[model samples]
Target: MLEIRNLDYRVEARPLFEGASARVSAGWKVGLIGRNGTGKSTLLRLIREEIAAPGKDSPIRLQNGARLGWVAQEVAPTDQTILDVVLEADAERHALMQEAETATDPDRIGDIHARLLDIDAWTAEARASEILMGLGFTTADLSRATREFSGGWRMRAAIAGALFAQPDLLLLDEPTNYLDLEGAAWLEGYLRRYPNTVLIVSHDREMLNRSVTHTMALEHRKLTITPGGYDDWLKLRAAKLAQLESQKSKQDKDRAHLQAFVDRFRAKASKARQAQSRIKMLEKMQEITVPIAERTLPFSFPEPETKLSPPLLEIEDAHLGYGPQAVILKNVRLRLDPDDRIAIIGTNGQGKTTLVKSIAERLPLLAGNRKVPKKVEIGYFSQDQLDELTEGDTVLEHVMRALPKDTPVAKQRAVAAQIGFSHEKVETKVEKLSGGEKVRLILGLIALAKPHILILDEPTSHLDIDSREALIYALNDFPGAVLLITHDVYLAEATADQLWLVKDGKVAPYAGDLADYRALVMSSDREKAGATKASADPAEDRRRNAQARDTAAPLKKKADAAEKSFEKANARIRTIDTELARSGLSPQKMTELSIERGKLEAEAAKAEEAWLMALEEYEAALKESAAS
Candidate 1:
């Protein structure tokens, strides 16, 4: 059990939390939800002990010696391999392994080795690799140094790392933000069967619905916990609110009647006692407090300046990538027109972003042209644009900068208000703005552009549910064409009228909706798991798997590297030997050839030795793989 008693926290003088209390049981996956800046993150920090909860003693308590696993919003990029980075989070396994390797005492080393097996250290790499893959890291990615990955990939690694730790309590903040639908799907399954408690703050509805067994909503400086998922919680909350409102109304009427009795009868000697008693009752009455929902952040995009009928933009056999040589999205034939709402869906790294960039003309197509109707204005919303905002500028300043130079300050403030920034929030520095605020600011800038076509990539990544719903409603009502690429299936389903699937280096229309795609993915995963299980006999499988961990893994890695070098060495010698095989040569040429051959022979000997060692290692791996 976890208890938060008088969890008082404050920002400046304002009480974000005066005295909040919450209790959660073991193994409960609770979805923490609230409006942006409503202290949800702060509550998580207090739970993680990252910050102090403003009380004398610690406000949070965990029974049964529980451990905490927290996924950081940002992590320093490391030079360790992705697999190594994830496995490093399993502190027990890492410690045991280190002790086993370095301890000079045989008894100590034996004890540590036993503990390593107890912690399943031998299979840690494989488990870490699977988790990494589930989060969309490729086989090649598992080997690559973390420093080679982009910030988003590093964030994924962080998520995988925290999951790999498998603590008694898991705190994930927007865990799916860096994930694609598939990755999010994997996460949902992972959390559903998680052995311990989970407290996650995410706007992804599917995740909330599928993983969370409970919801803890922080609003108006109070934390309220209820059983069931987000929708279930909302339904119960609504009913509770309605009941409270009714009670408040009845209480108000009772109080009014009591006051009327007191006014009418207080002057009469016989009725004065009764009136006084009624007055005392009125004074002692407890007011019924009707729960109020948080203030709404309602905003909408400005209508597009231009509208093109069908085929406003068309990409014909287009290929999208960086430069000319690196193509990520290929054979992409997609068309959109005004009134069309298309959501592009695919696994991460399958080039959804690239396809959008190609359609938006932000990146040149590698193979074919994208034809766009003349005078069509495109508003492409990307996180990169948000990154380009001036650091020192205020939210209002960002909007005004995008507006016409002659626009008045009053008009600018109005525009900012229209996009959800109000009062002092408008004057907040760009750097101080929360992620969702920055996203809206970027959207506000786009609203000013008034483009005919809107291309949004992961637009809801930073939005709370309220803001996400608002955006969906606005986009659904918008007249312009929309090309959206998002992992937020809820937002995608709500906003997109048509579905486009990006897969196998091509883009095409998806015949069904997000739900259908989800089913297919789930079925595919099951089939893969089933096939893998069916392929091997259970006892033999365990033995060989253990053998692979003990022998094959190290040997195969060494062998794979050595084979590459051997191939290169042999290729070079072939070229040199072929040159020496020429039929006729001058005496001077012969001398030069003989001398070169001598040097080449020494090099070949060293290469041969290395290659032989590699082959021996590979043979050992093969034997392990084939063990009975």
Candidate 2:
């Protein structure tokens, strides 16, 4: 639980929030929503007391005993094993374990034994293992050095470390950033079951809707906390916008009436006084201020002079990866048609990015034949666009560099303006631009290239919601082939026509909606959850029935076999339950696990009922068969 009272935040003399107050109550799951650069991350730092208030005497206070765990947007892995990092989450436990090992005296040995039992060491390990597995970490991966993994895998380890800590308040900044559909779904489910307070800054709407119970909107230098998710907030905002429009109309009518009176009665002494009073009142009335214009990138591809048939791009028996030692894709055969809007999806390090790079020719293939149309031009927007920009070059200079030599300077400036860069902004050094501005500049440069096939890798990474929507709109209307590798499921759903799901070093094509693809990836976890609950429910009943039947026939043989099966299943259920319990009944976790448990319990109950019905049917069948 945390409380921010009369908070003021500023950056470079610009006020971000003034007199903004909000409370994050215990056990509340809140979605922190705002435009980019609105101080969402700043607010999180304030809550964690990592940064000081602008004023020395500001009244921003955090509740006592509120442990905050934050997952940063960028993750840097140190040289350590994955398991070591995860175990570090329980710092106190690690200390206790170390102390226990060093104790040698008889009296100290007894004390250590008591402490170990009290801490439930076996249960903790089981819980840790379960959490690691859910995040897509195999037992083998746990021993690998973190330095060897990719950025996405490092992010997963960081997230696993935070969740393992089980803090009282979790602040997740774009937790879905580097995750694939499978990893994202797992995290969503895990957050649903979290019991502590949560304040999340994310752009994924579905994740927000499913995980959060409240929405916090930060706009116009103020914070408003409202009940329900983003959709509810949007509805409320629309109503407010309508009300403001109505108010503006009324003010316009009053101004018109006053003007008319002033014009009609200017010569009359008695009426002149009233007109003067109305004019003064109009002067005193507050002027309506329009909201800031939303940033957008609006440009469509130039119509292709000729459309090429068959074999837009083809990869035959290709192996894609970083190097010979770390290949992710082995013998992958892929074909792109003239109009294929394919979306590549998989967990980080699973080769979605490598596959895209291979197609873009950013990396050379180790072993395979890749054929592209003779005249096909490719425009590639790598994931780290900001890093790729020249440091000292101006925005206009960068755009001009991408243009053909025959193009005039005036035409280059005109193209830059169309992408939202103005005269002064065009002259600003590329190093000084914000993330969104960099993305816009890149788009402008890409537009000049006019490639037949466009490949975008996480193009929406730095874009705000409005800009992301605008880019999606442009991509949808483009008249060229596209291969997009992004984690934004909403964007993928809106723009892509086909999905290439990468799993276990193989790509499988799915000819359906993004939702269907998500369902396919999550089906395994859903089935496991269902089976566990179903198998656990009738466990005692079966045990009792087995006990009665064993007494009558093959007493030792049947009893031993039945007991073995019962123990095996019961052990698994107990293990899962222990992990769930250790997650600590936070509001978010409760909502999530309750949802999961409800589904599983429902399925289990249904199966039991169906089994009873089937028993009745089978008895009738036996009677009919006997008669025959």
Candidate 3:
């Protein structure tokens, strides 16, 4: 559906990609993978035709009449209801349906028929609703205004909109960023069954493995399109790295042997020819340039001075939310010990952020008290770290401002260097810093603070894979108690020692390993999935139940009357059978029909059981309504 030929993209004379070519076939699911700043998003934009390349041939060329839909990495909500925005994806179908609805006259019927043929109106709404539900949006959620939702939920709605379009080609950038495990699984299932082409950029290994049939890697100013998943790509990468290492070793050995031969005969007149020959051979040899190893930041967090007692931080019956319309978490209790590295898990907009904010002292709890030990010093890292930095200050100035008054200048410089900021980079203004640089600066300050407790909210956001690994390593080694709020399950599994699961306005302490935690989350999602299926349409359920009750009431009356009539018929049949026995009539045919009627009566009993079960379920649902 899309093709790139001899594409070269550059910014300010620096080449992002050179001579890069890739072809995406119909129904292909491609995972666009690369290190940060290697232009994964840029390549996507190029394929999307949102950005133009500087060459005779355009960066991207699409097949004729191929439609494209994109889910951006960052989404902003418009002032529209979630339903209207998703419905807009199929406006033509909607219009056709409207026309068909109003087509009462025979003259207008022909026009409606043509419109239906053009729009495929009959099946469009079903398809749209299916896509939306698969992405974790319900019919009820559809009507909610977008402005009232958080950024994460708004992104989900945007994703729903993109999928509802059912384009010929779909481009998703980090689609799983704001999704829970259930949402991610649903997307995987949808993409697996998708008939169109797909290209996605994601850091999630499971997502890439499950959703992508091919892997497109960008490295060394080139694009390598391979036909396999992430594991296959990783194996290929390992083989390439091994080959490079072997070649480097052979070159080193050959150089050492040549040097030894030259040294043995350099000063001997008798063997001067051999020496000259070896020297000339060395000079003429093609130099093997070993690839430069990637650089990594080397900051290790300092150990905590002392461990806190049990209940590191506690909330007693906390009620946290905004204003009088607070979404209360009542009678909440949690205890964190010194060794606990807890992961806060929940769906988006389900008080995960509110709970974290209260713990971080960014918000005050309305009802309950939160306690922190006197000896514990807290280090908090939030999504707003970038905003915390002074606009006009340089990177070094920012770090220096966080340093203690008695701290030496040399020590401060060393700290900055450890976080990959050099003397020159440190002098660069904070306003000019990129996202990664800003994160590094904030981490540097946090490390300097060396608090006993660290609370980080989505700390891995905007960080490259290498940076994430480095942070994980540092946190693992740190002696402090860590409280993390993140969507990166892999990171949580690697670093957390405890898990706290929040759902349905309550929090539960989970005592399990990472695998178990995943299973629990999946199980909870399955239960919710069943509930979603049962209550797919609240309005429809109510209507059907009301109609069923109405029909059932009249049927019960008729059934009673039929039972009375059947009792009379049974008495008459018995009398006739007795008379027939005396009259020597066989009466076998009447007996057979009587037996058939009895079987029908048994079937009626079963139907009554089924009806009662349905009614009981309806009643139980009402009883549990308060909990939901």
- lDDT computed for candidate 3: 0.71
lDDT of 3 by residue, 1-628 (tens): 8888888888787889989888889999999887778899888888777888886668688989998888754335556666667666665666666777777898788877877776666555556555555566654454445653445667887788788777898999878766765567668777888889998887776677777999998887788888888778989888888888888789889888988988998999998999899889889877766456677675466876776667678888877654333444556677666677989876543567667767777667777889988877777887666665755568777777787777788877776787789888878988788777787788778877677778888887667666777888888988878889876666787888787877666777867765675566456754454345335575765555445434344433444455455455546555544554565445786576557655645544444433433332332232223234
lDDT per residue (tens digit) for residues 1-628 in model 1: 7898877778997788867889999989999998888888888888877887755789898776788889876446666777788888988888777776678998888888888877777777767777887787654456455654557888999999999899999899888888888888888988998888999998887788889999998877888899988899889988988888989999999999999999999999999999999999999999889766666676576776665577788878877765342456666776676889888888776668778877888667778877877888888998666665665569888888888899999999988888888878999999898899889888878878888888998888889998888888888777788888888888888888788887766788889988898888767853353233122354654455456445545554665566576566557666766776787867788788767756655655556545544444343333324433
User: For each candidate, what TM-score against the reference?
Assistant: 0.82, 0.75, 0.74
Model 2 per-residue lDDT tens digits across residues 254-331: 988988988899779989889898889889988765456455557556645567877788899988764453456788
Clash counts per candidate, in order, are 0, 11, 0
Error of 3 at 59 (Å): 4.7
The alpha-carbon deviation from the true structure for residue 114 of candidate 2, after best TM-score superposition, in angstroms, is 7.8
Q: After best superposition, candidate 3 residue 280: deviation in angstroms? A: 12
- Which regions of candidate 1 fall more than 4 Å away from where they truly are? 73-75, 525-628
State the displacement of the C-alpha of residue 520, model 2, in Å, after optimal TM-score superposition.
3.0
Query: Candidate 1, after superposition: displacement of residue 598 in Å?
Result: 63
The predictions' CA RMSDs to the true structure, in order, are 15.7, 19.5, 25.6
Q: Quantify all predictions' global Cα lDDT against the true fold.
A: 0.78, 0.72, 0.71
- Report the CA-based lDDT of candidate 1 relative to the real structure: 0.78
lDDT of 3 at 354: 65
